[model samples]
Structure formats: C-alpha cells, structure tokens
Target chain A: MRTAFIKSLMSLAERDPRVWLLTGDLGYSVLEPFAARFPERYMNMGVAEQNMAGTAAGLALSGKKVFTYSIANFAVTRCLEQIRNDICYHNADVTIVATGGGLTYGTQGYTHHGIEDIGFTRLLPNISVVVPADGYEVDLAMGSISGRSGPSYLRLARGGEPVIHTKPIDQSLFGRALMIRPASDVAILSTGSILGEAVAAADRLTAEGIKTGVYSVPVIQPFDAETVAALARQCSLLVSVEEHVTQGGLGSAVAEVLSGLDNPHARLERAGVVHGISPNAGSHAYLRQLHKLDANSLVERIRKISNLSAKRSVKIK
Target chain B: MTAATQTSTSLARRIRSHALRMTHAAKASHIGSCFSMADILAVLYGGVLRFDPSRPDWPERDRFIQSKGHAAAILYAALAETGFFPADWLSTYSCDGSRLGGHVTGHGVPGIELSSGSLGHGLSVACGMSLALRADKKASRVFTLLSDGECDEGSIWEAALFAGHHRLDNLVAIIDYNKIQSFGSVANVLDLEPFADKWRAAKWSVVEIDGHNHDALHKNIGHMPLEAGKPSVIIAHTIKGKGVSFMEGQLAWHYKSANDEQLAQALTEING
Candidate 1:
C-alpha cells in the first residue's frame, strides 16, 4: 500500500507542477522514490508535525496542492489545530496522508496505534476522511486526491497489505463503497484495511445458506449516504465494521445514516474496539483475536443482530 | 524628517487616538497591545508595505498578518485611515453585525491577510506564505507581528525554528515586546529576556529597536531579507500602554476601558 501510494504521488507530482509533498521525517525508505525524483517538491520537515502542517497550509494558500505525510497520529492528531485553523479554516488545498491506520503497528505498543485518528479527523469541517481498503484503492485515491480542492485525510495501513479488489477501480467509485459479494438481507459494511475479515464473514454466512451484502467503504467521512440509505432499505440489519473505537469511526457514521432513515424494520449494529486499551500486546492477528475483530467475530455479531441463532463458537467451521 | 516620515508619525498619533475611542466605546481589552504596535503599524501601512489598499488580494502585494490579533482596533484603524475602507467603519468596530470584531478576522475585511487571534499560529502561517511565494519565484514578502507574551507558546518556537530551518528569507517577524502580558509582566509570567539570542539560535537575522520610534520602525521594517538565506526578526521593545499619559506603563490599561473623563483626557493627550 505504501509503495502504491508513493508511486501514485510521484506520478501526480510529475504531471502537475503545483503538487508538493511535506513529511514529518517518518518516511525513510518508503518516500525515497519521490524525494529523489522531485527534490524541490519533497521536503523532510524534521520531526515537527505542527510546523509541517502549518507549512502545508501555507503552501496550499499560495496555490500549491500539498500533501503532508507522517506516520499515524503524527500526521493528523499531532497537528490537528493546524489542520483545523490554518488549512480547513482557510479551506486550503492540502491532503494529509497518515500511514499506519488502526493497529498496523501492533508490536510497537498501543501508543503507536492510530486507533482514534479517523474518529478525531472526522470531526473537523471541510475535510474529507478516506480509508482505503488496499493498494489498488490507495493508487486510485492518490489520483483523486489532487482533484479535491479542499483539505483531505488519507488513511493507510503500513506497507504490504493484501489486495482485495481483483480488477481496476474507476475514478467515479473513489468516494463510494463497492459491493464485492451479493448474498442476504444482512449487510456487513466494512471500512479501512479490515475489509478482508468482512469478506470472509460474508463467505461464512453464505455457506450457511444466509445471503449477506459485503460492501467495502474506503471513503469514511463523506460516505455514500444515499447508497447506504438505499442499502438500508433492503437489509433487515446493517453492521458497521472498523478497526477503531465504536464512538466515532465508520460505525458511528453509518449509525448516523441509519438514525436519519424512517425505515421501521432497519436495525444498526456496530462491531469495533469498544473496550479500553488492549491489556495484551502481540502481533496484529493476536490483537484482533483478543478484541474479537476477526472474521468469526463479525459473523457472530452479524448473526446475533439479525435474529439468527449463531452456531456454537467452537463449531463454526 | 521627510514629509512621508512626518506623515507616518502623525498617522501613529491618529491610530492611538482612534484605538482609545474604539476601545472605550466597545469596552474591549487589549488597548495596551494596540497602543504598543501603533507606530510600527503606521510605518508599515503608511508607505513601507508594498501594497495598494484597493487591491487587497493583489498577488504581488506584500502580505502582513497581525498575529497578535487582539489588537484589532489599531489594525482596522490603520486599514481604514489608509483607505482600505471608509474611516466611518471604525465606528462599527467590535459592534454587533460589524465586520470588525474584537478579534481580527479577514474574510470580509479588506487589507487583512489571515483571520487570527491565537498566539504562535501566525508566524508559521506566514512562513508557509513565504515558502510558497519563494517557490513560485514571486517577489512578494510575508510579514507577521507577534506579542512578547505570545512567545510563551511552544508553537512560536516551533515556527521560529521552521522559518530558520527553511531559510525563509522572504518572511519577516516583528515581536511587540512591550515587557507586559495579560496576568503580569512578561518577565514575571515567562522570562523571554534572552529573546534575541533565541531567535538568533533559530537562524534568524535579529534586530532590536524601540518600537515607538517611527524612524527606527520605518528603517528596520521597510527593509527585506536583512541577510541572505535567513528570515529576519525585529524585536521592537515598546511600552504596553503608549501615547496616553495615565495609561502608559499601566497594567490596568490591558483590560480597562476608559470612562468619559478618561476618554476626554486620553484624546487630548493623543491630539497633542
């Protein structure tokens, strides 16, 4: 995903003279290609996130399209006020790229985790919050990012994530969710890099003679509300899946959409990290299992919400 | 002194007088702040800043941001008196439905660059402005005026370091070092005594001047990029409450609005 994002960024810079990239000194090997190609456009803004954000806003204010890069919270939360006042208040043209969304850096402890980034960034006005599912979506998002006139937040996991989309993604589908599978009245709406678990959950339900709607929503902030509302009408229950807190992530956004609907039978269930910080730390897989955010967890949560008696936990296979 | 320099001095007096009346009417604070930077503002808006008041958004115009934005009355006065708007607009300052609020905002107000009130934000934003201008090969410069007390914020140091690190020679910072702050003296609250040294450490070409001296203010501010490849910072040491006799060096003036008698006396002192 990092490779694809950098390649896309290089191409965007190559095509447009207005494109400029600033980093908080976190991009080591990942950003070399662009830095080597366009040394003038690429800047390593030390480790000062606030300064980086302010400079990005300044650049954007001067008619340059800026992309500020850093790992996780450093990119978004560390300099949130700069993003809020300097960038968003002026409505400057800058894209904030946050690598390591969610628990991609699990072994580095919870502090390195970007669990609350999307939730925090989602509250700011005039900025788009995007969480791409894979490398293909990352490439597509990079292409669309330059065309976005206002500030935007691009959420990505650390490099080497699996590719979920098997084919080319159209530009029109950039801000909208995609349905990869068609099965039942129950819909599993997943966001971020956790779409793999959702896809597997849909398959689990399909084998059990239950049709499930699997949608991968990459753009989380300005979500496809009309489509979600349209999907809400067909499904008995809508389950929001994310690798973030249930309060303000994809789940809360989907719940907000569900709340505005007048459908009598529509029910919304959110599956995300609801507990306090994880007491046990290991790998991403270990953490996901401990928090019950894996595939089986989604299948169980979906069944519980849809009035279907979920099979015994051990006998799921 | 030349005619323009004499005009700048007189303009400074008018700014102080106007600020006194506005602060008295609106019952707003920061009158002390407004008075301290009056001469510096007069010099900049008088003729030093490369600008046309009618063309507030001109690309080539040198950008000036009032980072210590609580002093909106003086900024508005400087703009209005210079014909950015009608001088009549000064009467509506800080009033309900008025474009001129107590804290400076720029969306509707002409001649203002960025809407600002928060300390330590303006310099970095100005640095950004300078960085972009240099990148575009535009000769336009970015100037920011901050407060001594506002330097207590960590972000100010961050911005200073950033401007220095980037070699933002197109950028300039003027600190309104009035020796006084909100709660107490700047020394008592947060000692920035080695302030020039600190700026020098950040790689800025530092200049110390009496902020109230019109000739000194004009001479220092009119110039650009004091040295090659370095941002310039002018530490204009000033009095908190300037112009008015009773208000000078008085901390009470920081928050106090003038009574009728005081306003009369203040205006009398300013006119003289």
Candidate 2:
C-alpha cells in the first residue's frame, strides 16, 4: 500500500506543478523519486510533525495543493493542533497521507498502532477521513483527492499488505461500502486490511447455507450513512469487522449510523480489538490471531451466532 | 511627505486615534501594546509587506502573522488604514459577535493571514510558511511580529532553531520589544535579557533598531536578505505606551481600561 501511494503521489506531481510533497524525514528510499524529480517541491521537514503540518498549510495558502507523509501516529497525533488550526481553520487543500494505519506495525508495539487516528480525525469538521482497503483503492483515492479543495486525512497501511480490489476502483460509483458478495441472511460491514478476513467469513457462511452480503466502507468520515442504513434493513443480522479499536473505528461509525434509523429488526455485532494491549509482543500476524481478527475466528463467531439464532426461532415457535 | 516622516506621523496619528476609539468603544485593554507597536505596524503595512487589500488571499502576497495577536486593534488599524476592510469595522471592534474581536482572527478580516493569540505558535507558523514558499520556488516572504515576552515561550525557541536549521532567509521576524507582558515587567516575570544575542546564537542574522524610528525601521527592512543562509530577526526596541502620555511607561495600563472620562481625555490628547 505504501508503494502504491508513493507511485500515485509521483504521478500527481507529474500532472500538477503545484503539488508539493513534504515528509518528516521518514521516507528515505520510498520518496527518492519525488525528491529527485522535483527537488524544489519535495522537502524532508526533519522529524518535526508540527512544522510539517504548518508547512503543508502554508503551501496550501500559497495556492499549492500540499501533501505531508509520515508514519501514522506522528503524522496525525503529534501535529493535531496544527492540523486543526492551520489547515482545518483555513480549509487549506492539504492531504495528510498517514502510513501504518493499525497493527500493520504490530511488533513495533502500541506506540506505533494507528487505531485511534480515525476516531480523533472523524470528530473534526471539513476534513475528510479516508481508509482505503487495498492498493487499488489507494490509487483510486489518489485520483479522488486530486484537484480537490479543503483538507483530507488518508490512513494507509505500510508496505507488503495484501491487495483486495481485484479491478479498477471508480471512486464516484463507490459508496462507503461496496457489496463484494451478495447475501440475504446476514450483512458484513468491513473496513481496512481486515476485508480479507470478512471475505473468508462470508465464504464460510455461504457454505453453511447462509447468504451474506459484504459491504466495504473505505471512506469513514463522511461515510455513506444512506448505504449503511439501506444494507442494515436488508438483513436480519449486521456484523462489523475492523483491525481497529471498537471505540470509534469502523464498527462505531457503522453502529452510530444504524442506531438512529428505522432498523428495528437489525441485530448488530462488532468485531475488533477490544480495550487493552496484548501481554506478549510478537509479529503482527500473531497479534491478529491473538485479537481474533483473523478469518478462522470470525467464521467461528458467526457460526455460533447462527446457531443461537436457530435455537431462539425454535423457542419463539 | 518624505517616506520616513510622512509614514511615521501619519501612522502614529492613525494608531493613536484608532487605539483610543477602539478601546473606548469596547472598554478594553491592550491599548499600551497597540500604542507601542503602532509605528512598527505602520512601517510594516505602509512600507515592507507586499499585499493587495483588494485580494486578501492573493497568491504572491507576503505573509504577516501577528504573534502578539491580543493587539488586534493595531492590526485592525493597519488593515483599515490599508483599506483591507472598511474603516467603519473599527467602530465594531470587540462588540458582541463582532469579527474584530480582542485577538486577531482570519474569519471576517482579509489581511489577517493567520489567527493568533497563542504567542509561540505564530513564529512556527511563519517559519513553515517561509519553508513552503521555498519548497514551491516562490519568492514571497513571511514576516511575523512578536512581543518581547513571547520570546520566553519554548515553542518559539523550537521554531527559532528550525528557521536557522533550514536557513530560511525569506523569513523575517521583528520583535516589538516593549518589555511588558500580561504580568508585570518581562524582566520581573522572566528576563529575556541579551535577547538579540539569543537570536544571533541561534544562527539568525540579528538587526537591532529603534522600533518607533521610521528611518531605522525602514533602513533595517531595506537591507533584506540580511545574511545569506540565515533567517533575520529585527529586535526593535520600543516603549510600552509610546504616544499616549498618560499611559506611557505604566504597567497598569496593560490591565486597566480607560473610563469615559479617560477616553475623552485620550481623544483630546491624540487629536491635539
């Protein structure tokens, strides 16, 4: 995903002479092309996130579309005030490309985890919060944000993430959720790199004679509330899956949308990292399994729910 | 009307008149700071900055951030004097729901480049603006006017180090060293003595001048690019209350606002 985003940024630089790329000294090899091609336009702001955000705002104020790249936590949290005052207040055309969107940096521990970024940024007005599911979606998001005005936060995974969008992603046709596979009995609302797990769960459910419709919501801030509600009404059961904390991640956003509307029949369940850190430190894959954010766990949980529902129907009869 | 005396006297008269009127209307303080920095603001808006009042967000306009933003009346006077907004807006300053609040805001005003009340943040924002212009290969400069007491902020030092590290020559910071903060004397509060040496030590080319002397102010600004590969700091020494005789050199004015009678007297003194 990092490779795709860099390539997309390079492409943007080629097209728009006004695009300036700034990094807080994080991208050494990944940003070489931008640094080499447009030395004047590319800057390594040297580990100062506040300065990077302010500089991005300044560039935007000067009529240039600016993008700042940094690791997830430093990129968003460190300079949040700058983002709020300089960029959001002015409504500057700046895109904060935040890499390492969740436990993608798992072994690196809690400091590197980007779980709360969406929650924090979602509260801000006039700033679009985007979480692209895969590399293809990252490319689509780049196109979606180009020639766009106002501020945006793009949460991205680090390099070597699986690709999910098998074909071209037309951003206009895309809502917060995309129905990857259709289902009538249950609906799965999934986000981020956890889409692979949700997909596997859906496949397992289909084998068990339960039709599942999976919706992928990439844009989390100005989420397609209309689509989420519509999908919620279509199924009796709605389950949200994310590789983020349950507090305000994709689950919370989806639940917020579902709570107010006319979805009385909808039984909602959310699957994500609950509160608290892991006791042991290991690779991200081990962490994913420990948190039950993997496919097998998701499938087992859904199967158990399905059995409970069957018993409840017999009790009603 | 030679540039030096004409700009000084005209701006001083406007500053005194407006400062008296704004504070009188709102019954607010910051009158002392306004009076002290009036000449400096005059020198900046009248002479140095490249801005178009007609187009507030003009792409090439030189950026100005008032780090000591509590003196919105000064910037308000400067902006109105420059025709950025109507001169009538001065009357509504600090009124209920007025855009011209006690501190500077970019919401309704055009010439206000950044919203500032937080002192140390402005220099950092200005430094970033300069870095951006350099990165974009634009020649426009950024000038931030700071109060002497604001130099005590750690964030200011962070920005100072950054400006020097980046060698941001296009960035020019001028300190309105009136030597009074919200508390008592900056000396009593926290001494920023040897302040010019502080900037010089931080790798900024330092220029010291009488902040009120239009000739000195203009001369120092005239020598832009003060040093290659270094940001420039003009430490303009000024008084707390410069033009108003009753308010001059008194720390109490920093907090106390004039009554109706004092307003009448100030108006009389300013016009006279």
Candidate 3:
C-alpha cells in the first residue's frame, strides 16, 4: 500500500505543480522522490502536526494543492482540531494522506492504532473520507483527488497489502459502492483492508449453498445512499464488516440508512472489533487473528447469524 | 503614502470612534482590546499590508491573521475605512445573520485571511503561510497579531519553535502587549515579563516598542527580516485602551459594554 501510494503521489506531483508535499518529520525513505522532483514545493514541517495542518491550510489559501503525509494516528488525531478548523471549516484543497490505517502498525502498541480516524473525520462536513480497499483502489483514489477541490482524507494501509482489484479501477466512481459478488439472501457491506476476509467468508457461505453478496464501500462518508438502499431492499438480513470498532464505523454508517427506511423487515448484523483493547501486541496478521477478524471467525459469525445449517438440512425436492 | 502618515492619527481616532459606535449599537463588548490595537491596525491598513479592496483573494497579497480575534471591531473599522466594505455594514455587528460577529470572520470581510477566534492559533497559521510562500518562491510576507494573554497558550510556543527551526524569514508576529486580560492585569495573572528574552532565546529577531507609535510601527514593518536569516517578533507595548481616556488601562472595560450615554462620552473623549 505504501509503495503504491508513493508511486501515485509522485505521478500526481509530476503532473500538478500546485501539489506540495509536507510531512511531520516522518517519511524518511518513502518520500525521497517527491523531495527530489519538487524541491521547491516540498516541506518537512518537523514534529509539529498542528503546524503541519495549519501550514497545509495556508498553502491551500495561496492556490496551492497541499498533501500532508504521516503515520495515520499522528497525522489526523494529533492535529484533529486544526484539521477541523483550518481545513474542513474552510474546505481547503488539501489531501491528508494518513498511512497506517487500522492496525497496520500493530506491534507499535495501542497508541499507534488508527482505528477511530474514520469515526471523527467522516463526521465533518466538506471532508471526503476515502478508505481504499486495496493498492489498486488506493492508486486510483490518489489520481482522483490530486487537483480536485475541497478537503480529503486518504486512509492508507502501511507496507504492501495484496492488490485485490484485478483490473484498473475506474477512478471517477469515488463515492459509489462496488458489488464484488452478488446475492439476494444476505448482503455483506465491507470497507478498508478487511474486504479480503469478507470475500473468504462469502466463499465459505457459498459452499454450504447459502447465498451472500459482498459490497466493497471504499468511500465511507457521502456513501452512495441510493446503492445502500437498493442493497438493503435486495436482502432480508444485512451484515456490515470492518476492522474498526463497531461504534460509528462502516456498520454505523450502514445502519444510518437502514434505520430511516420505510421497510421494517430488513434486519442488520455488524461484524467488527468490539469494545476493549487487544490483549497482546504482534504483527498485523497476528492481531487480525487475535481480534477474530480472520476468515474462520467471519465465517463462524455469519453462520451463527444466518442459521444456514438448518436451512441446508431441509433438502430441496 | 504620505496620506497614510498625515491621516494616520485621525485614522486611529476614527477606529476608536467606530469601536465605540459599533459596540454600543450591538450591546457587545471588546472596546478596550479594540482601542489598544487601533494604531497598529491604522499603520497596517494605511501604510504596510499590501492589499487591494477590489481583489481580496489576490494570490500574492500579504497575509494578516489576527490571533487576538476579540479585537475584531477595530479590524472591521480599519477595513471599512479602507473601502473593503461599506461603513454602514458595521451597524449589523453581532446582530442575527450578520457576518460581522463579535469576533472576526473571514466569510464577509475582505482583506481578512482566515476565520479565527481561537487565541494562539493564528501564529501557527501565519507560519504555515510563510512556509508555503517560500516554497512557491513568492516574496509575500505573513503578519500575525497576538494578544499578551494569548501567549499563555502552549500552542504559541509550539508554533514559535517551528518558525525558528524552519528559519521562516517571511513571517512577522506582533504582540499587542495591552497589559490587561479579561480577568485582570496580565502581569498579575500570568507574567509574560522576560517575554522579549524568551522570543530572543527561541531564535527570533525581537523588537520592542510602543505599539501606538505610528512612525515606529511604520519603520519596523519596513525593516522586517530584522536579521538576515530569522523570523521577527515585534513586542508592541500598549495601554489597554490607548486613545479613550476613560477605558485606558482598565481591565473592567474588557467586559463592560458601553450604553448610549457612555458611548456618547467615549466618542466625545476620543474625537478631540
């Protein structure tokens, strides 16, 4: 994910002179090309995130499209008020590229986990929150928002995550949902890097003759309300999946649409991290397993929710 | 520009008159802070601050961020006097649906750069603007005005350290040392004594002068980048209510809104 982001930002910088890159004394090895190519436009504002965000806002006011890159938690959380007042309030054209979304740096401890960024940033008006599903999606999102007006927060996974999209994803479908797999009985709404596990869960359900569809929602805020309403209408039972906590995340966003609907028959179940910190710290894979975000746990949870075994037992004529 | 110096004193007097008129009409307060910074705003709008009333969003225009945003009435007066907006708009201050609120807003006002009411946030924004200007190779300067009490905020130091570390030569910060805050005298509340020393220690080129001195303010604004390679901070010593005799050096005036009679008296005292 980091490699793809660097490649994309470098390409965008080459094309747009207004794009300036700023970091909070981080990005030592990854941001070399941006510095070398756009030396006049690049700045490392040192360890001050508040200043970095404010600086980005100032640059945006000067007709310069700005990008501030740092580890996710530090970039957004530390400068939360500045982002709220300076960028979102003014609708400045600055992209807050927050690397290490979710538990991408799991071993670094609970402080580094960027789990709640979506909850806070997505709530602000005029801010488009993009949670790319994979490297391909991340690359496309970069191209879409480079010179685009208004503020945006690009939540990225650190290191190289698997490239999930087979072909080049259409960059213009920014706020729309993608139907990865289709079904009528149950629709699974997934976001962020956890879509891979969601696909595996759908496969397990399919083997047992249980019909389920996977919906990858990359843009959490300003989600395709029409698509979500249509998906809810297709299924009696709706499930939302994400690596973030159940509070005010992808599940919460989906529930917002479902709760307001005239249809009272659709029941919603959410699969995500619950309250409480992870007991042990380890790599990203280990943390996912510990938190029951793996394929097996997702399958078991879905099985319990749908009661598919009993349905399978009643054989068709 | 000679009109700037010739009419600057009267312009400063007009700012005080407008502050009294606006605050009384709106039934709001902040006359003291407004009076204190009148001459500074006068010098800025009249002499320094390269701005055009016609093109408020001009890219190369010099930037001004008022950290002590409570003194917004004075800014509105100066901006209106310079034809940024109609002087009649000052009547709607603090009224419902009025853009001229008690605090400065960037929405309706021209020449105003950013929306700021939060103290200690302006310097950081100004530093950011200065950094961006350098990156663009534009010689535009950024001027930030802060109150004495606002320096108590930790974010101010964070911004000060950053400006020094980056060697932001295009940034200039002026501290409106009115010696009084909402509670009481700033010295009795939080001592910024050794304030000049502190800025000097932080690698800034420090200049201390009477904030109301028009010529001094004019001279310093021209001689900015005080040193060849440093950010500059001007410590402008001022009376809490410089022009008005009744409000001068009185902390109670910070919260006391003027009634009809008091407003008349304030106008009369400032006019002559």
Quick one: best DockQ, which candidate?
1
Q: In order, what is each prediction's RMSD in angstroms?
A: 3.2, 3.1, 3.1
Question: What is the TM-score of each predicted model, taking all chains together?
Answer: 0.95, 0.91, 0.94
Model 3 DockQ (Cα-based): 0.62
Query: What is candidate 1's lDDT per residue for A230-279, written digit by digit as tens?
Result: 77777776778888888898988888887787745356778887567576
Which lDDT value does model 1 have at A288?
A: 76
Each candidate's number of clashing pairs is: 4, 3, 0
lDDT of 2 by residue, A172-246 (tens): 844457778885778888887778878888998888887777878788878888888877777777888887888
True-structure Cα RMSD, model 1: 3.2
Name the better of 1 and 3 by lDDT.
Answer: 1
* Chain A alone, TM-score per model: 0.94, 0.95, 0.94
The candidate with the higher DockQ, 2 or 3, is: 3
Q: What TM-score, to 2 decimals, does candidate 2 have? A: 0.91
User: In model 3, which regions exceed 4 Å deviation?
Assistant: A308-317, B1-3
